[model samples]
Target chain A: MDCLRCAYCNICPIYRIEGWESVSPRGKIQLLDKKLSNRLVKDFYKCTVCGLCEVVCQSKLELTRIWEENRAKLVKSKKYMPAHKKIADAVLLYGNPYAAEQEARVLLNSPSNVLYFAGCMANFKVKNIAECTVKVLKLLGLEFKVAGKSEVCCGSTMLRTGFIDVAEKLFLKNVKNWQKMNVEKIITSCPGCYRTIKSNYPKIAEKKKIDFNFEVVHITQFLERELKKLDLKLGTVTYHDPCHLGRHSKVYEEPRNILKKIGYKIIEMERNRDFSICCGAGGGLRAQFPEISEKITLERILEAESTGAETLVTSCPFCVYQFSKVSRLKVRDVVEEVYSSMREVELKI
Target chain B: MYEFPNVRVEVDPEVCKLYRFDLLKVPKPFSAFIRTPLAVFQPENVKDLLEILKFAKKRNLPLIPRGAATSAYGGVVPLKRSLIVDMNRMKNFEVENGKLIAESGAVWFEIERKINKKGYALRVYPTSALVSTVGGWIAQNGYGIGSLAYGSIAENVEWLEVVDFEGLKKVSGDELKFYVGAYGTTGIIVKACVKLRKNNPLGVEAFETSIDKAVEKIDNAYHAAYKNAEKKIFLLAREDGESNDLGLKAWKERFFPLTGYKSTFSNFSEVIVPIESVVDFLSEVEKISKHYQVNFARGEATILIILQSRNILKALKIIKIAEKYNGRPFGTGIFFKRKDKDFWDFKKKIDPKDLLNPKKLKGNLILNFAGLIAWIA
Candidate 1:
């Protein structure tokens, strides 16, 4: 991971908030190179792992990996923040960071080829995203099964918070669960889960030499093809690219494709697509540093507001959860907007 | 033991490590030269800066005034245990009286954007304008995108408000030269009143031409000379709606140099030569290094030689190569202190205690020895 210290500081989200070099990717890399102890581990965690730095990085360093790997080292050495430890513990104990019952998380059990992986965020925190995703799936006449009690966490949170070993355990368990259920494709509403399963799982499977064979797709990627043109003029709406769905997985256009098909005018924020600012919900920042997290969230919210759009549509549950907390504009998962638009067409029909 | 409650100071060793170096990686043997500061301070206002300055004076601590830490030279890197005044937090700027008045820490891109909105444009801004602060650029006295039309950053400045051990003082004309490229060895530049021009619709045009011919045609045009991998000099100049793809690309990518390389990182150094000698200089270096980028603006050409490794010694070889073609290093910052005797004298008079970025204006033997090796190599 050669980091060209170009100091493109404007692209960094956390650095923008704290105005501290320690929080920037370049600064963290420099510190990491120095091999400093746990005193700066918290500064490393301050990032949203948005991959914004990587986009403009002259060295093209996989900065998110560097941040995550450093965090994993910290956790391994028992030097990570207590909040991160709590989330890791909650995931290990309850299969969800929210500490909800696994049985209660099993929303539906009807066996089907496609699995709707309503991630922990959708299931516990922002339930409406899951509901909207399910509603849209049903409206599209897609046969999908809920993972039921077999669906453990997708391990996005764990992987991001430096508990990769724990995340790998969850990844293996989920692979086994999906294999037993005989699902051919996995659709998730959370970008975190989408990225974790679609990107991280394959790597882990190869490492473990497990026969993990399930096609993973975010809800927007899945719905983009199935949704029809509504042409209902849903007014001007801005799309927020969740760090996981957009930069991490390169799924920038699928959600935008769906939004356009739904007949909504998409006015872009000054920062969009690969350059989109983080919603400050990912990378465990929302859980660990709530105030700093909210400050970042507010900045994004203000950017969304500046678009003068009626609704702020995003593809990820975490983005919706964070944006909804502070945004004055209506924050919605792309699935919700699609569901509402489909429902309106159904009423007209 | 010392504290200024009014300012944000970090004595945490871990955090201090983050400020140990600037954009330059300072590879290996040279890396050992940069010491982590004892404490880092973020001064929000002049009063806070004064307090931090006073505290440093009392403790006999050297003050490292830094803005964005964008310099590749070890300008911001502490030579010993020092107090770093991170000027980034002091960013505050406004357009006033047909000129832009900005705090030293104000980023150039931010200033440019704000001024552009008010129908004014900066006369010159560094290629790292997006991240580099005004004070930082001014400290380097950089020449960039608009430098051809407006000259070096020093030429466009109205005045500068610099803070020293005593208090804040406004310096302009002859006094400004001491601070412009002094690398903060004299005092911390708190604010600057920069000359601005009316915002015009900027377009670009590129053509292959000799460096001398390009210089002949670049009258009052915002120009940049880029010699591609093919050894063709493409002079990209600001025009009106006549941009070919190459011209637009060169203009669009003015900030990013030699980034198209497939490598994870690039090691580069900037050297200035006579505009007429740019072609020969680049041709000479190209024979050896094989990888270089030319940014010809103002009356000089800045050749950025992208090296193969992180070694500063290797980068210094380009400087030695540059000297053969009558070239000099762009910014004197600790690395080329010998080139600017006037700045060294000013540093002593302004900061008599040598408490302001010491060991910076004074070049050391080890670095000079490295230069000797580079010259021999």
Candidate 2:
């Protein structure tokens, strides 16, 4: 939608990382131009969408957002990432964004009363996070029930994969399910689903008058609010700023403070906060460009390793899954970060 | 030399600051400033530069005195913030004394021709004599290709006329001579009175030997000449194909073989002839190259003959006698443009000041000048 071709090509991370002008945001703009002009685009998936370009942009342009927007337009015009499209289709059909259904769901008071939606990653690849989430939330003495096989996709994977129209359809389906289930509060371990439910549910509700609403909270925010009551004794933990939670939503301080009360040291990386390097998993680029994403992820791990913390912590399940794949680093979900230090996880409800 | 008519002008200090930062970001733009004003305010002859200055003042702009922007460090604005006054336009020049009075805009090529016309050859203006303006060259301490022998631009200039944000002042050889290489911090240089060495009919012309042998033999030769001069004698080594990134490796391979030959491009590298101490330094270069991996081959060079006709025969005889040293005539370099190959386009691409601004050699601008000088015994 916007042009990124300007002289600020100097110090561009894509160019800096790759050591060439052809891979930078401006270069992508040129590639996009060629693709649009019927000149044929080459290496269409070289970008990892690390958001480093967004950091250097004086214009504050979300270049990745532009790519995703362009991708949607491309898909409409039949230029699509087939693998990505299949994943998004899975999210559309199954209750999970992954190709197959996952059986794990956490205990909440009711699916509607206080639904704990463990998004695809935590539900499948990172099932331990879901178990820890159930244990921790129940320790607070909250009423809960398990919807192990009945949970639906939060439409986050579809949105990221440029299936917004499909995402909206799924969103409406979730609204109908939540209204029928009478969900008063929805808690999600995934920032993607947390944001998708929070930002999109209201729009879907307004149109459909689903009339089933209360609060949608990320697990970090839920733990932060009940932190004093729960008396978390975890000491001094180093927290990794998950890209979606920290940069996308600006939820940085709550998780840090929660980790502190849990008695853990919070050591930071050289690049943190808004400038935090991507963990190499976003923008559907992992499927489209794995090496590009892997290098950025490796760099982020190296940054964490430099901190010398025993436990590397984060709040998103996807970040949890990605970090778990990195060797020699003690990567744990923020829920695990909280539950580990607790003499117990309260799963009584 | 061409006469440029005067134009109405005024000076401004503010706009000069902006011009100096075009495509460059400097905390202090003043260091890039040169005090030699090429935009002249003759107030008499050519007043266009003066008018331009006036226009700058009216527009609330600073006046920047620029030479060729080739110094390693920033030079366009030597002062904190200043306007750029380019003096490349002034051309009419004359050489009177060993000192030559030249317009600030006139480059070394024109000055060289005027001096040679009078049967006097200047030992100054070496590499920069081609494209460097007298004022800019002085500011940069530019050395001709024979820097090891003649020193830099500062060693070549005798005096200057400089204008500043304060007022116009005359700096001469009689004044502070060290200021020649100050790179316009003294002020905007508007004119220069340079010193020229007389041409000795019996001086040596050309010679070539291994860089090591030439370094050893050149010192003895420099001392033997009555006129007493020394110059760098070297040749460029070139090979085909830049695709393999062989610019440096290929040149180095001409004499010394490097271990790794798999580099994609030739990495075009050059052999440097530093100062009068070349003889003492050749071995050091070889050792350092071995230590640090510098790609260069030691080779012979053609020295310019600067002696009389009678001695010219003797110089040629010595060159022939030195044939055992492995020496030969080096033809001119061949360069093909990457794009835009027009007759005049080639000339436009050359920096015309390459030797003076050695940095320009990699680019499209090189300036050349040559002429005849006659003397009666």
Candidate 3:
């Protein structure tokens, strides 16, 4: 790609916070083009794969695809980072990237053809998001099954870091489990999982000659389709578009429309929609570069704070996790916001 | 023999390689390829920059001052095993009265956002404003976006703080003009005070018309718009595509659909000409495009022409046509064809060793030829 260096790096979180071109998208592309030694492998791992670079790219370089493919090539060359290796090992050993024993955090009250795939983050890390997701599903009066402990890591971290072999195994295992459940539809609250399962899974299935019959949808898309209206009013809040859900999956309007239906005033961050900044929690960045990830998260929080909104709402659990840790403003997942509003209506009765 | 500050110079090959090229948007000719710099020095503040400049002068090491490295003409490309002075870390900005006094590394978009909050905006900014540094803009003396009204960055600049072997000096007016478009050949621009105007959104109206009609309309409408308008009227015409007016509307609505057009190995030319000769200039552009079998269009102004073609020869032929029509290529440093011996003389006095961006004086002929050859090869 002929990089015009339009200076979109100015908006890139990793480049802005780290203050180095080596970690910037342009620098990474240069390194890839030169096919340099493993010395710059760490630099490639520094990106959050938030798709901000691709969105603002004047050349519209398929940067995300390049990054992922290069990352996979790096893994094949055995030049991948050790931190990413650890996450891959965890996924292989425990069926989850977190290496925790799988347990049903929220049990499904009734089994249905529709499966709620509460991803690794929602299942173990952010339990509230999983609970709220279930509550929202129930509030909408839809019979859905929680995959619970049956859900393996979607291998998003592994896939993003270039461990395609390991990710394929996890993808196969998840697909097998879904097939056994006989689920017709899969809904995920995590954008990372949503994107991987919806977009990435079919490719792997096609290659592996496996039948991946289930249709996948994010919680926002699911809720937008099922729920008629949310009557409660939420005060002015800013929406943070999770990188995967917004840019990766092209699901920008569903969450906003859901919020609008609830009578909430939405203020936009300067960087929103496809141009939305990352919470610095994706693409295995937080695991490999925690300090840089925290700095990026802080920047996103500051952007949210700039809007003077009382709350920051996001559709992805990972974004909520990152924003909640740093932002003074209340960070809520779209599901959590919907559930809370539903609960408020019940209390009024 | 001079000893550099321990934290200032980085000899790491990985780090140094990052500064080897700017965002020139074209492949370097095989012959023009330069080795990665021996080291990269990132200055955190003006004092650090001055010290580095002094050290580079003492050691007689060629130094290339870089800000965002977004120059389209390889102005920041390191031509030898030199020291690359990375100026992005020197970001410090403050507003005084109606002017912005900022360190060279201060990003244009960030400055725009900050000043915009105060009901003021930059008088002129590059199209790469999101990533271009204030110092780089001044150093390159760029003209873009708002130049139709405010003129080039050099015109909008109130003052500039530069440092070389001669130490620091704040120059304004005619002296400041020496640094504008000089690249870093004169001296390293450490900071600048740029003029600002009240932040008023310009009303953009797109018309579907041929290049001839568009040029005529812009000439008449621009005059009327400039009479009392806070912001200058800008126009864009798409030559061979679906209506760009709809595309512009989509962009304004923040739902930009990806267009199938990819500018691969395309030749682009931006030229400025007299306002009265806009129609004639456009006719010449059309003639060149037809002769070369390339696509050409006007953007925002009659003088500004954009040409896209996979054939490098056609693109080169178009550039020649622009020159024939008295159209000067627009860019920072030596990208433009302007010959100024006085500026070079002044540059020699300030940078006696020519340590700062020594390759800055090279014309676009070599660069364009290199792109053409690379594409053909």
Candidate 4:
């Protein structure tokens, strides 16, 4: 694709705030085409892999795939940012990037064929999202078991940061654990985990020559199918599209459909669907450049704030966590919002 | 070693290579004219820009000023190993007394948005407004969607702050005209004060018609709207019916497609004529296209008679026909045939060394030669 340098890609959250061509998507592509220097390597980590660039791309270039591949090349050459190394170490040592202790495994060994992989974020950083997913699954009367402590990092961060070997190991371990459970379906509230398991894991498994089974579905997709089961009356709320769920996976409609069925008035942000901005927490951005990450997050919150919606609903736990940090408006996972509304209606009945 | 005050100089071969071309829609042979810059510079303010100019002048290196690089012609394309001064970092916008005071690099769309929030809008803007910078429009002497109502950027601009090797000077009236369409030959426009209108709703009407009927239909529509004394009417005609939908989408998004089939090399001609001569000029274009066996499309696309041909000779023939009908190439840059002798004389006086965008002074001989080669090869 010809880079017109039209500055249409200037709307990127990181590029908009940083105001440097070196950090912009078009700039990075130029840098990659020429050669990757230490500065270019540092700039690559600045991207959150939001996929906004790909969506707005007039050439429809596979920018996300290109970025990921370049990142892998950088990692192979040992030219990656130090923060990525720290995350890799933490994931390897603790089975999570957060470096929390791995308590006794909470494998229920239930006879249920469904499994809820809460991921690392939902497990520790945003536990309410996990509990809410469990409660909603129970409310639906579906037999499902939580991965609990047994679930390792889905290796999304490792893969995104170019630690392919580390990601492969984690992928194999997670697949083996799930195979032991004999599950037919896996549901995740975290878009990172859902995207990795549903998309990236298959590629990794094929490379390792491992047979992987079990259908992977995000909670939004699962809840969308079971939307008729719940009775809810949610207030006017704006929905934030998680980059992983909306752009990477093309799961835009399910979350919006679920919100509409729950009786909430969906006030759309100016940038929605494929054009939605990132919540500034994905692709190891929050880990490597927290200050830049916060600025991007603030910009997103302001966009949501402009909608005048009292509540901001999303399907991904990472987006909820990031927005909740700086947003005055209530930030919630779609499952949590629906579950609470369902419980309220039950009490009223 | 080169040094400038408060400016970041990038000599990275990778980054410097990207500045080699603007949005020039020419065939591959013509692309050979694009020359890579020796280095790229980002100046933060007028002071930095002045210092860079001085530095370039002392060394006698060609200095090319770039903003957004959205020029349909090779306005910002360097002629040799020049210093490309990217002006995007100097985006400072302020509004006072119904006037927009913006730095040259301030994006036109961003300025429109800011002023819109304050209940004001720009008098005129280019179709490429989303990515086109205020400085670029001034340099290119642009006219677009609202030109029929507000005239060109030259008419809308009130004052300009221009920097040359000598120093900075405030130019207006005739002096400002030198910079418009001069393609940065005289000096660099660092800041501009443009007239703003009250944010008024524009009534847009789209219709489908054969190329034969397009010019008359659009002219009659404009007259009819004028008779009604409607605030303003923006008329756009596209030869491809399918493109109308794409145009509408672009209008809604307020952005031009950055990359697409349109970005490919082609023989594209944009000609502007007096309202009375538009029909005649378009008919002539149609005749030439048929004679040359060129796959041509003609219509009133964005207040100009745009004739596109797949064949290079056919495109050149159409441009020649447009001149016969008293039409001039639209926009002020390398694409157009006519030169403003007065502007050139003024540019000679100010930029005596002609070290800024020296390619603008080179006649269309190179383009003509390339077009001939393209037809043969």
Docking quality of model 3: it rates as: medium
Q: B125-243 in candidate 4: lDDT tens per residue?
A: 87677567999888888776456555677888999998988898998887777777778888888999999888755444433334444344543221111110111122352222233
TM-score of 1: 0.93
Going through the candidates in order, their DockQ values are: 0.48, 0.01, 0.52, 0.37
Per-model fnat list: 0.62, 0.00, 0.57, 0.33
**Candidate 2 residue-wise lDDT, A155-181, digit = tens:** 776666667788778777677766667
lDDT of 3 by residue, A1-349 (tens): 3665555644678888776777888888777756655557777788888888887775678989999999998889888888899999998999887888887545574568888888888888889999888787777788988766777899988889999999899987888887888888988889999999989999999999988888889989987887667656668999999989999999999999999877789999888898788898889888888899999889889988999999999998898888888889999988888888888888888
TM-scores of the candidates in the order shown = 0.93, 0.48, 0.90, 0.83
Report the lDDT tens digits of candidate 2 across residue range B1-377.
02323442323222122223211222132223333222322222234444544454455444445543323233453332233455544656876756677777665655665566577755555332433467766765544433334445566666677653334567665443434544443345667776666654323332323454434434422111101122222222211212223323332222211112222111111222323433333343233221112111123222322212222223223223223234321111111112223422432432122111122112212211000111111
Tens digits of per-residue lDDT, candidate 3, B109-205, equal: 8888777888887766666677788888787777665555556777788888888776888888888868877777778888898888787654445
Model 1, runs deviating above 4 Å: A33-37, A103-106, A109-111, B25-33, B113-120, B204-220, B227-239, B244-252, B262-266, B309-314, B338-346
lDDT value, residue B44 of candidate 2: 27
Better of 3 and 4 by TM-score: 3
Model 4 quality (TM-score)? 0.83
Per-residue CA lDDT of model 1 for A70-139, tens digit only, reads 8888788777778888988998899988788887664666668888999888888888878888888887
Error of 3 at B66 (Å): 0.9
Task: Say which candidate scores most in DockQ.
Answer: 3
Q: List the residue pairs that clash in candidate 4.
A: none
Report the TM-score measured on chain A for model 4.
Answer: 0.95
